[model samples]
Target: MSKIASLVPESLKSSKPSLIRVLNNKYGSDPEMVNLTVGEPDFKTADHVKLAAIKSILDDHTHYPHNWGTPGLRNAISQYLARHFDLHYDPEGEIFVTEGASGAISTIINGLCEPGDVVLVPCPAYTLYRINAELCNAQAVELETSAPDFKVTPQLLKEALDKYGDKVKVLVLNYPVNPTGVTYTPDELRALADLLKNYNVAILDDEIYADLLYEGEHLSMAKLLPDQTLYVNGVSKNAAMTGWRVGYICGPRDVLKALAKVHQAAISTNATMNMDAAQEALLHGDEDTAKMKAEYDRRRKFLMAAMDKIGFEYTKPKGAFYLWVKVPDGFDGDSMAYAEHLAEKAKVAVVPAAAFTKLPVRYFRISYAASMEKLQKAVDGLAKVFAQDQAD
Candidate 1:
């Protein structure tokens, strides 16, 4: 018998890499590293939310839930959507609670895409969308949104639909975007909705950061195009419940039925305790979310001011806790190199723009999710590095 040299298939070998993990592994263990690479909130889950989870566990709400989700949790998610986005959804038919927002994206990819189907993803997007598309054997056609504003304009959407034609089955839209921290306005969402309506494309709207809008309220594309939108959200960012691993999807009944099949086969169901906890977080955690958002707003102002003083050009982000700043003039525009330089010299770790896509090279993402004191230290470290460069 011939020895098996390579057990994994070529498809698995050719899969896209995880940028967050790559950066984490490179700088995570360094004692002096001030990591601004991760996209998680730095706040703790509120005491009341935690108490609710403990109460649920103590009361023995631990049985297996419905394959779609617990009825109460689904109802809570529906109400949350309606109250926030003014969108109506029948919880029983339209909602499926998943492991996290990442799971929701995976479920949609598996449910919607067949072999060779194309997914339209804007560049500098949350990295998971492209990876999920690849996992489903679908082509992720990344349309660059590195224009004056990092948004997928109606013209760009039209061009992608025309180019990919019938192969394009899904378009991923993330507002309060990771890496870029840009959120779409209601008018902008409506225009894009109209353009997408012309095609048979389905939307995967990841509104995980919807609650962190510093400038104003977040506008959901799903509100305008609910029929074709698979809206994904969760408690991870808003309630600081990343470890709880609870998220949900709401969409048309037929689409949700398909996603339920994929979800059930993959994970069976989300843990009952976590779902119970999430129900509480959704229904009674508004105050917790508000408090965290206020703190994030303060850090946002400080980071933006620091970047300006350091001569870094950046868009004034309206939502999300990130600043996408351009590298200083005369520095090599390669963000990976700059990131490594900062990490080695200044002990500050940030994600490079190249990690998000092959669009431009002058930008890097700084997460303001750390405390103000740590953020201030990072700013001072960065200032010293820039000053040293200027002197040299």
Candidate 2:
């Protein structure tokens, strides 16, 4: 191997792929495997959104667009945020489009972080935050919030701030959080805001699953802490356009200006056609999201009931299509080993909790984004696994 290969940063060289992708790769080709390890929506992009992309193509919109994003798409996103979350952002200087929410997260972390800076990440996190922080030569302090219903509380924030002090540069907040599907109520968001209001840290609020809430309304931290929150969202989850790779970052003009420089250096601009499709999703795709969300709600309910019957312990998810379930009793609390056993014996796939955080956890995350029939098959396999463990 070349010296350049050895010179690659330890963060990138040593990091493992996400557990979701690893399981998908390992069992995706298995004829009998019931893979529920990915957080992707199982819905297709809305036809209208596709048509918008086609229209953009036909209009010869294939050339390079604005570096920030097409003005029309940014305006659409501005309106979407206002309509959905009661948050306002200036489309001209405050909104920027990136490759996807993943890319947006990378940009924000890279932009704001310096060597030795600390990022407060509430676990079980999306996993990417830790990797991103490491890549930026910063440290990720995981404030384990699994005991507080997986929702970050004011007390937790206070404890993290007190310990990390001024070294803390950002707080990565994602809700309808992945893995757990727990979201904060409006009042809860306000309390967090109150605690962080005096702090110097920026809040990178990732609300990519905002449109998929089933129980209560979704609230944006940007509304409460507009000056200090970098709101990240995209059409991947709600519009089922993951391949499109269109996402936006909106925030205070000064902060966005700095983020825009990083974004521009990263990807120059997102694809023109994808931005057109995203514009349609933002402006005219609420019903499309609602339709997909209803199906997800059904799947979530069925999965919750099945987990209960199988004697697995988990909190009922209210937003994202996932369950953070404890390892069934009678088995050693080793999520990776348990997940591999299920994959080999029962032909089911799940992500071990170790993939999300460094905490010694005995839980696995299940994504219910598959069809009802597929979900039923997975439940059947899990039921067998649970019974087999109990018997042994």
Candidate 3:
């Protein structure tokens, strides 16, 4: 008989392995390695949240969850947004939970996009957006936002809009952005919103790190353009509940209903126990997140000062736990090669900027999500590497 094998999905067949995971797997086993490569939070999920999950399981609430999530969760999310972002939605009609922010992005892109549509993604961004766009058969057009500060400027938006026009269906954005710790000011977002309002593109605002801001007030674009914004967030980053796999989508009724169908088809719903835990986190974990943020701020300042002393140029982080640093001159500017060399010589690991870019740029990101002790060690290791390179 002839050998037979299942065909892989075209998307998966060509997809490159996630560089973040690859680097972690390669360096994670080394005893002396200080792995600053991944963004996994060092904090444990709050005790009350863990207890809620346990209580749900003991109370026999482990059956299949509602596709739109539990009433309590949806209502809590509505209230959370209203209180923080000053944006209101009907929990019954506009909220839908998914496996994570990644799942929610998949649901929205696959649900909303048609073949040949363009999804505008800002470069040096979270790589999942580009991968998701490719999987959905839409063009993931990246506009590089590295020059003049790492932000999506109004002029850049206009240039892309003029070139792509109605073919653009969705604009994906993440602030307190991954890789680069830069975020937009409210006035900056409002200017982009003014141009966006004239176009028919919907906004996918991924605000998973909204609560981790170290400077400036966090603003939701949905507050400025609610009719066209699909707000995606979760307890993963804020409450250190990443393994819980609970995330959400809030938007206008019609579009949310469409996304719900995709959500149902993809995973039905996230686990009931996880949803219960997420509800508890959302309802009462502000203190837990606040404490974590304060510690992260301390680490952030320490890392920036250390980088300056070591002679690496870095953008001062505004929010989130990552520091974006430029490859110093006199070194070849291949971020992946530079990162690997650092890991080998200094026993410190950082993610290469190539992982997050759709353009050719030289940068790398160091995550401070580790403890202050670990961050200090990593910085010391990095300093040794820089000094060694200069000597060589």
The lDDT leader among the candidates is 2
TM-score for each of the candidates: 0.96, 0.98, 0.97
Question: How would you encode candidate 3's per-residue C-alpha lDDT over 1-392 as one tens digit per residue?
Answer: 33443465676667777788888999988889999988878999999999999999999998887889998899889888887778898999999998888888888888888878999998888888888788777899998886436889889988998899899999988898897888999999999999899989999999999999999988899899999999999888899988888899999999998889888987888888898899999889889999999999999999888998999998888998999998877787598888988888888999988899857778889999998888888888888889988998
Q: Largest TM-score belongs to which candidate? A: 2
Between candidates 1 and 3, the one scoring higher on TM-score is 3
Question: Scored by Cα lDDT, where does model 1 land?
Answer: 0.87
**What lDDT does each candidate get?**
0.87, 0.89, 0.88
Give candidates' CA RMSD values in order.
1.7, 1.2, 1.5
- Candidate 1 residue pairs in clash (backbone atoms < 3 Å): none
Give the per-residue lDDT digits (tens) of candidate 1, residues 245-307.
999899999888878999999999998878888898899989889999899999999988898
Task: Give candidate 3 regions above 4 Å deviation.
Answer: 1-6
Over 4 Å off in model 2, which ranges? Answer: none
Model 3, global lDDT:
0.88
- lDDT at position 295, candidate 3: 90
**Error in Å for residue 180 of model 2:** 0.3
